[model samples]
Target: MRFGILVNEGPFNHQASDSAYKFTEAVLRKGHEVYRVFFYYDGVNNANKLSEPPSDDRHIVKRWSELAKAHNLDLVVCVAAALRRGMKDELLAEGFRISGLGQLIEAGIQSDRLVMFGD
Candidate 1:
């Protein structure tokens, strides 16, 4: 099955992101495919590659990046959320390109299920 995972919480001050990551990992291990991981609201922090976690805490940013790289997953971040949180991907910050709900819509239809990890 194809899955679309939507995360809506920041990596810190909440367990939503970690839960999302675990859910994604489980989906992949079950022989399912992830259409995309959509980051909305504070979830956009997952896309900010500059995140630096405390030495004792887990490095969630790098873990998310690895998930995308290892599985060739589409990690989609909501442009509005990203900008509001000061997260930029060079292209967006430079040319002011922005992602929209369309990305979420497309992934939803293409995938068999939409899983939301909320706090």
Candidate 2:
């Protein structure tokens, strides 16, 4: 089955992001297809390229980026949610471009299921 996961929590502030990552790995291990992983609210922080966890702590951003890259997964962030939460990326803050719900709609329509994971 094709699955799409949505996250709505921050990395360090809560375990939602960590849990999502593990769930993602487990899903891929079972040979199920993941259509996209959308990060919204505090979860958008998971996509911030500038995040840097301590050496002893889990590097959420790096792990997330690497996992998506390794599996060629569709990692998306909700625009309204992201912007409201102030997790702006360069492309977002520069001119407030389009790359949020449009991507989510496409992913949602294409996937067999839209899975939500968060607090």
Candidate 3:
């Protein structure tokens, strides 16, 4: 199956990001394809390249970055939401890009299922 994930909250503030990450991993492990992982609202924080979590704690941003790299994932941060949150183009991680809402709409239209994690 083809999946599209939509995240709506910032990393660390809620379980939404973590859940999305785990679900994405599980889906890939099951041999399903993830068409796109779109970050919206505060979720764009997940793509922040400057995030530095505690040494002993999980690095949410890095985790997502590595996951995207390993899977060749399409990780897109909503341009409007990311700009509002002060996430600049230069600060985006390797596998992430800032894009318009149309990208999200197109992903949803192309995927076999759209899963949303938020709050």
Candidate 4:
């Protein structure tokens, strides 16, 4: 099955992002496919390249980036939400892109299931 994930919370402030990541990883491990991951609201912070978590803590941004790279995942941050959260094109993580809600809608239509994780 193909899954579309939507995250609406930021890293650290809540566990929503972590849950989304773990769910995506588990889906892939079970041989399912992730169509895309759309980050909205504060979740756009997950795609911020400038995020610097402590060395001992989980690097949420980097973890998402690496997951996208390893699985060839489509990681998208809502342009409107990202801007509101101060995430710019210049600060996008390596595997993340700024896009419109149309992408999320497309993912919902294309994937077998759409799973949303948030506060």
Candidate 5:
């Protein structure tokens, strides 16, 4: 199956981001394709390159980047949401790109399932 993932929460502020990541990992491991992972609202924070959690905490942003690299996944941050949070192209982590909501729409149209995490 092909999936599109939408995340609407921040990495540390809620469990939504973590859940989305795990779900994506599991789906890929099951031989499914992820069309795209769209980060909207506070979820755009997942693309922030400057985020630094405590050493003991899992680095969610880095994990996303690594996952994208490993799978050649498209990790997209909503341009409007990112701009509202002061996230620019230079501030984005590896494997993440800033794009408009059209990408999300495209994902929904192309993927067999559109899985959303968070409100």
Candidate 6:
């Protein structure tokens, strides 16, 4: 099945981002397509290139980037939400792009299922 993922929470602040990532990974492993992964609200933080978690912690941002690269995934951060949180194109991690809500809408239209994580 084709899937669209929407994440509304920060990577470290909540488990939503982790859950979304795991779901995406599992779907890919199952040979399903992910139309897009839309990061909105605090979830936009997942694209922050400057995020520096402790060495012991899993690097969520890097994981997302690598996953996108491996699967040719579209990892999109909501432009409005990102701007509000001081995230710009240059600040985005590799494999992530800043786009508008239209991308999310397009994902919903194109994918068979729209899976959302977080509130």
The 10-residue segment of model 5 with minimum total lDDT is 44-53
What does candidate 3's lDDT look like per residue over 1-119, in tens digits?
A: 99999999999989999999999999999999999999999999999889999899999999998999999999999999988889989999888999999999999999999999995
- Go through the candidates in order and give each one's C-alpha lDDT: 0.80, 0.77, 0.94, 0.94, 0.97, 0.96
Q: What lDDT tens digits, residue by residue, belong to model 5 across residues 1-119? A: 99999999999889999999999999999999999999999999999899999999999999999999999999999999999999999999999999999999999999999999999
Which candidate has the top score in lDDT?
5
Clashes of 4: 0
Evaluated at residue 85, the lDDT of candidate 1 is 78
Per-candidate TM equals: 0.88, 0.84, 0.97, 0.97, 0.98, 0.98
Q: Which residues of candidate 1, in runs, are more than 4 Å off? A: 91-98
Candidate 4, superposed: residue stretches over 4 Å from native: none
- Model 2 clashing residue pairs (backbone): none
lDDT of 6 by residue, 32-99 (tens): 99999999999999998898999999999999999999999999999999999999999999999999
Name the better of 1 and 4 by lDDT.
4
Worst 10 residues of 6 by lDDT: 83-92
Ranking by lDDT: 5, 6, 3, 4, 1, 2
Q: Candidate 6: lDDT of 12? A: 89
Give per-model CA RMSD. 3.5, 3.6, 0.7, 0.8, 0.5, 0.6
Better candidate by lDDT, 3 or 5? 5
Candidate 3's TM-score: 0.97
Error of 1 at 107 (Å): 1.4
The residue pairs in collision within model 5 are none
Candidate 1 lDDT over residue span 65-92, tens digit each: 7777788878888887787778777622
Pairs with steric clashes in candidate 3: none
